[model samples]
Target: MYPLIYGGDARILEEVLEGTHPGLSSLKCRFCQINSLNPNLVKGKIVLCIGHRGGSEAAWSAFLAGAVGTVIVDGLQLPRDFSRIYPCLHLALVQAMVKELPTTSAQQGTGDNRIAEYNIESGTSMACPHATGAAAYIKSFHPTWSPAAIKSALMTTATPMSARRIRKPNLHMVQAISILVQNLRLVTGDHSVCSKAMNGTVWDLNYPSFALSIPYKESIARTFKRSVTNVGLPVSTYKATVIGAPKGLKINVKPNILSFTSIGQKLSFVLKVEGRIVKDMVSASLVWDDGLYK
Candidate 1:
């Protein structure tokens, strides 16, 4: 199951609840206590329980009430150590809502007939399928591509969650498909196949994310080599841009401009890093922006 950590924001959670489950006017006493719940009302349905006591306790009560699944949401900031005992999802105050709730209907159906059914919930669990589906679609076209290559395509092409100001995977199927097609051609060569097959370091993995870690009281310089296979039209050039480099650190990318003459042609570059000693963490990103692609 895909797990998501919600940011701490009480107002956002309340806003989500007001829109989706309007009937749920009160969260203070809703399923906060086991004795407060009516089994008939909760049976066979997934329960959204308040995490006043704790997620574990709340989940147990929901299970006892015959809920198919449980969602624990509390307005307070909590540690990320909540255990996954059942099919349960925890939402932070910031990640208040992800699921699209169904609109309530006033008209009731006749006997032996039913109206449309709507299941509204939100979590990384619900979001994971979109990424998986994108992967599956790519696999269908390039049955010969290895899992690593497919993963690289997805990671390298994903949109950064900068708006949320968080470092995480935000899946975009259209972009993934485009990148997969281009990456397939680039990695199809005999020389590119080996590197594409093996797993590499996070920064050098052709991933969509960038991360740099410098241990406390340590001053060091590091260099990384990254390769790109030309899969687009022959004889195209791409330029690299570095943004948000941490202060007190020197970062450089050699041969920042890449030119490819043929499909499967490989180009390698070195990223040199020299930095002063740091007490806390430092972060930055290097992006390749081709004329047609970002």
Candidate 2:
């Protein structure tokens, strides 16, 4: 909806609506939001650009948002035309984004990129959100949780990326995110897996696999909300549930029964997740079973 208001070329808008791109709209919205905001707010500010290779809209959004410049990197090899599109001589750096340390930047034609532009870009876009979500959980479960405490929880609970789909990992499909968050439990929080209390999916071990990240290491629990879309068959009905809910932790789904017609349909319902982090990790298998429509 907002995209229409931004008013790009008619041809670009047409391609966007076709839905051939994965995070194009996400990229578009991010760019729009940041661009709409004050440039001063983002100048010298850091932004996380994920999965789009270097050509990702993430970098564009950051640049327009007033970023001193972007640390353009990718999970894979950096692209050739990247420097051509985003010249480095203009800003601090023009390089691949990495989450790793000893952050470095490579320049083009003339080695004019600055040394002050040292920052890691090792896929922090993916890393930052999980941290943010974990902090949210700590705040929810322990209302008294301080910003510092929440930060501690997130950093302490951090885990490494397990594996990728072998096929094109760069593609951002709802199915890929679902499998990543739900199946691998790569992302922590209630939104990780919608449960019955949430009035959503009914737990089914065999159908949808469960993966979870426990909010606490030594002790304590937390709550969180996750977004889920119908990526499987576009049947008329859909539900959600947590496979093995931990102690003190509870899951609930809002607007449980999902009914829709046609393709590309989306429903955003909150998953009320609250509880203690009895362990370092909690896993739940969410099952989207058939209903009347099926």
Candidate 3:
């Protein structure tokens, strides 16, 4: 059977199959009864909620109800969103505005006729401000940190978020090249230094999130480069783990063990992924964990 679990990763499925994550079995409930949902039953599980607007309402409500994730069967997956990042994140404000906003004719209606929707709106307004504030906060503490470094701090230190579909079309876009590689040689591995940008793929950009958009049942390999700064205890060691990958996937992190000797020290790692697309969408995450910190 096709894996129908929305926002579910391989690790989550493995746990449920092994009877480890019993709370993950799908739960279908009425939207009107969201408040009545028993958290004890929903906790650690992924809830299925039918949504009419942007799925945030269901996602946010389920998040507050303690669900690990949510599946919103809606008319469309308009505006990509995942509850994993921040339970209340609103990347765009259009969804909330469209809900409560009245049409031109309705605005002039009698007071008794107009429907009133009182909502604690959540969207980009909240998220943008939070990011800006957080970035400013990080800047205040480390005046020497560059904007990119500050950005990395927020990303690498923040709690894990949800995943999205990665465009994995096999078609390669042919672009006009002004400069060619001196030797027409392929650059392999992180150590291979190339002055040209053609040697790298957009997917390998150093970002906190990962997404795979591969055709079904096709094998592929990709690599990403990420660096983390030592902000915690000195002389601490950290290791990387791949969590929530789909079946038949293999992830390797080179120099798996990160040992830091001083604060503000930065170390980089190359994460290689090997796997075939078993489904239309594949999602996973890499975690760097120390005994004292995640």
Which model scores highest in lDDT?
Answer: 3
Candidate 1, residues 1-294, lDDT tens digits: the string is: 422221111112455546764544344435334333445555666556655564545545555655555666555454322323344333333342333324431112122122234322334675567778899998998787677768767876775444334423344536754555447766564333323445566567554354556677566687777777776678788898888766777788899999889977989888888877454655666877779765
lDDT of 3 by residue, 119-188 (tens): 2344556456668889999989988787767887887678664444221222233432333454333322
C-alpha TM-score for every candidate:
0.51, 0.25, 0.48
- RMSD values for the candidates in order, in angstroms, are 13.1, 21.3, 17.4
Every candidate's lDDT = 0.56, 0.43, 0.58
TM-score preference between candidates 2 and 3, better one: 3
Off by over 4 Å in 1: 1-116, 140-144, 162-210, 276-282
Ranking by TM-score: 1, 3, 2
| The best candidate in terms of TM-score | 1
Q: Could you tell me the TM-score of candidate 3?
A: 0.48
Q: Could you tell me which residue pairs clash in candidate 3?
A: 84-161, 85-161, 90-123, 90-124, 168-213
Better of 2 and 3 by lDDT: 3
- How far out, in Å, is residue 16 in model 3? 60
| Model 3, global lDDT | 0.58
